[model samples]
Target: MQTIPAGNYLIVFNENGVREINNLIERNRYSSIFLICDENSHEHCVPAFLSEIETEIKIEIIEIEAGEELKNITTCVDIWSTLAEMGADRKSLIINVGGGVISDIGGFIAATFKRGIDFINVPTTLLAMVDASVGGKNGVDLGHLKNQI
Candidate 1:
């Protein structure tokens, strides 16, 4: 199991990591919590998450179009708009439930919404679980652009 330590933050990892999301949320006293997922994750993970979380906190699910191409400024705009419409605020917490694309875009969206918010990565893919999710490097790649700016 891996532990993500950042300032006052501590996240534990394990096979049943997904099951503990709600408890962790409660412990943190997050004012609001939502799940941001792509089509694939909505189908593959949501049901299991729903079964495990036992809380009265309203759980909002926001599903965006699934694909690497959908990870961009436009996608963030759409998600941010939706969050606004749903009355999400600075105290809100976002749980990203997908692969690298979702984690990156969701992190960016949460980062910008109401200036900033808390985000947890519930990465579903092997690449995300092993690499992208742990590195803390999040941003959409500029199309047709060189790595060096």
Candidate 2:
């Protein structure tokens, strides 16, 4: 098990890291749990994650379209709306599962919702594992401009 200390959190890299996730959830006792997945992660990674994480806590899944094009304020609004509709409170945790796009957008959603909430990144791609999931950099493009605040 490899663990990298990132700011206040520990990024554990292991085939069985879902156990860590379970432990974190149990330890934190979050009020609600949310899983944000892109279309690709929903189809490819969600099953594996679910199988590995053994938790009685109910989890709500939010699926978004996969692609950089969909990473924007619109998508963030949708995620925030869903979280609100699902009764997510300040103690809710958001698990982002997918590649860079999912992590970036999902992290943004989690960070902005309820003035910020706990979030974990489950990067499912090499690009995300190497870059997006490490730095905690999250943002969306503004129209045709990339990463335009």
- Candidate topping TM-score: 2
Worst 10 residues of 2 by lDDT: 140-149
Taking the tens digit of each residue's C-alpha lDDT, what string does model 2 give over 42-69?
Answer: 9988998888776788889999998999
Best by lDDT: 2
Model 1 lDDT per residue over 61-124, tens place: 9998888777777677788888989999888899998998888888777777898898888888
TM-score of each: 0.87, 0.95
Question: Runs in model 1 with CA error above 4 Å?
Answer: 1-8, 144-149
Candidate 1: C-alpha RMSD after superposition: 2.4
CA lDDT of each prediction against the hidden true structure? 0.79, 0.89
Range of the 10 consecutive residues with the lowest summed lDDT in candidate 1: 140-149
Off by over 4 Å in 2: none
